[model samples]
Target: MSMQLNYNWLLVLLSYAVSVLGSFTALQLAVAIPLAATQRQKTAAVVMAGGAMGLGAIWAMHFIAMLACDNGMDVSYDASLTALSALVAFAACVAGLMLVGSGRFDWLRLLAAGICMGLGVAAMHYIGMAAMMMPAKISYASGLVALSVVIAMVASTVALWLAFNLRGPLQMIGSALVMGVAVCGMHYTGMAAASFEDNGGQLPDGYAEGLRGGNLGLTIFVVVTILLVLMLVLHYWRQRYRSSISI
Candidate 1:
């Protein structure tokens, strides 16, 4: 009995690990490639396409895990749901672009890159988490192992992308910051999406809550003000310096 129990536990651990890792890898593909796209748009597009396909791959892997563990995973919906989710995710990406563009940050270019990456991560997490359901009949623990793997893979990919693509100290720092935001966004979104639907979780609801919180709007206004002031000061200073050199 003892030996049998240990063998069963081992299978559980291994299966959990594999599924989580695959999911995390899916997240990485979503986040890193979008940020990298700013530098290599064509290459980035290819990466994005790969990421879309990866969704299916990860889902298949998760299904396999469920089968192995007798957890009973099924997708009762059609591919249209997947496509709809992808469209929603892309809309989030466009919103990120608009937000970054509206604010005049000291590092606007870098900020845009980071925001896009972060949004991608967030979209991937929530979308992936919302993709399936656990049968009320099967008493299996949530695949947190799979979720962790997805996050770690994403972080590592972002780090690698930054190391290879970003140049200059400031740019590197900006890229890192962006990737960090992406990771955080991804985690929260994934958690939210994975939560029980009846447990009061909706993406639009979260967005509205953030906006009504006032903090976000104030923070954006303050940053924009600071950036404007800095730009004015820099312009005058540059002119003075040039005038002196000419004289």
Candidate 2:
């Protein structure tokens, strides 16, 4: 029989909040890339934006959502895979942001970047799911899996376009809202694609040693706190930049 899966609604809301905040910070960081006067400045912007999107928005939100899941079974995650998944997400966001942030914007670059990010996000989610060490086997519905990927690509492209093309308050809030949709949509859809079947208590090796929910909770808290700081810093920096140019 499949486990009776449920969720902590508060955590689900928090997951979305984290996604939005990460998206907001990343989108704001990316908007400044075009105005960067040198290669070094552009590179710095890309890295910061990528980190905000990948680590804060995608990776951290994923773990929070995972922790929110109440599967009625004790679960742990493989340390290496968990780390690898974050790396993949970070690298992908960096590459994608770099591609679109540099040079003149075009459909081709947008498409390519979207595909890269979309695949990366999907890959991270699946890889994270694989990190689970529990007494159950998980399978996915092929169609829903594919649908989730499509949503990731489309939403990412739209968000990036909004960030690059728009100005004023709309740019930051709009792009971030869409990006939040991209992250949250892909996550929950991928989760919906999953079906967990009960196993004969054949837990994975080292399950006892794997990272547990309590560990992840603390990590998520730290990530959220850092994200908040980044947002404040970004806002302060933007204000300074605007004042300098206005004078």
Candidate 3:
């Protein structure tokens, strides 16, 4: 039997919102990574920026997307696994930045960084999927799964390139849009790969009821909003300091 899937349009829209926000934040961090590498004192800042991108963009986007999915079965999540998935996403972002932003730009480095970042994203997705404590057996279509990985790797590579090369506000905005699409594409495609089977069983102990889609969406909105504000403040402060030093 064909697997049935239902999506809440509102949640789906929210997922897109998170994607865009995350993409912009990531691009900002990508631009900062190389600059930070030039100054050892900024190393900690780079990591913080990377963590923000990973947590806000990659991990949050995935979580919101997952909440958008409905399979007509009782579903919840394991709290610990859910939290761990965020850490995985953060680590992936930091690794990607460190690899590509080491002040040694090269094709090989780009490729390796892209692969690592892509795989990191895929790992976070699957890990988050595993966090779902539903009474259904989940399976994936091998072909779609492979396609999703390819998309993630290629998109990540291109995004990193743009971050390193692009300049000006318009270029940044354009890059962010492209990256947002790529991130969302990888996510929904991965979602397409998933197929669920109801096993007629109950969730195991320690499984907390999942947040309602609406609730999750609202929470993500608040979190992303706060992060964006912080990013803007940091950006402004950095620019101001640079201006002062130039004088």
Give me the candidate number with maximum TM-score: 2
Residue pairs in steric clash, candidate 1?
20-145, 20-146, 24-149, 24-150
Candidate 3 residue pairs that clash: none
> What digit string (tens of lDDT, one per residue) describes model 1 on residues 44-83?
5334423322322222222222222221222222234444
| lDDT (Cα) of model 1 | 0.37
lDDT measured at residue 206 in model 2 versus the true structure, 0 to 100: 90
TM-score, structure 1 vs. true: 0.31
| Deviation from truth (RMSD, Å), model 2 | 2.0
Deviating ranges (above 4 Å) for candidate 1: 1-78, 86-107, 133-247
Weakest lDDT window of 10 consecutive positions for candidate 3:
205-214
Give the TM-score comparing model 2 with the true structure, all chains together. 0.92
lDDT of 2 by residue, 33-53 (tens): 898889998898889888888
Q: Please list the Cα RMSD from the true structure of every candidate, rounded to 1 decimal place.
A: 17.8, 2.0, 2.0
Q: After superposition, how far is residue 91 of candidate 2 from its true place, in Å?
A: 0.8
Tell how far residue 224 is off in model 3, in angstroms: 2.0
Clashes of 2: 0
Q: Which whole-number lDDT from 0 to 100 does residue 79 have in model 1?
A: 36
Q: Residue-wise lDDT of candidate 3 within 100-157, one digit each (tens)?
A: 8776899899899889988988888889898888777889999999999999889778
TM-score to native of every candidate shown: 0.31, 0.92, 0.92
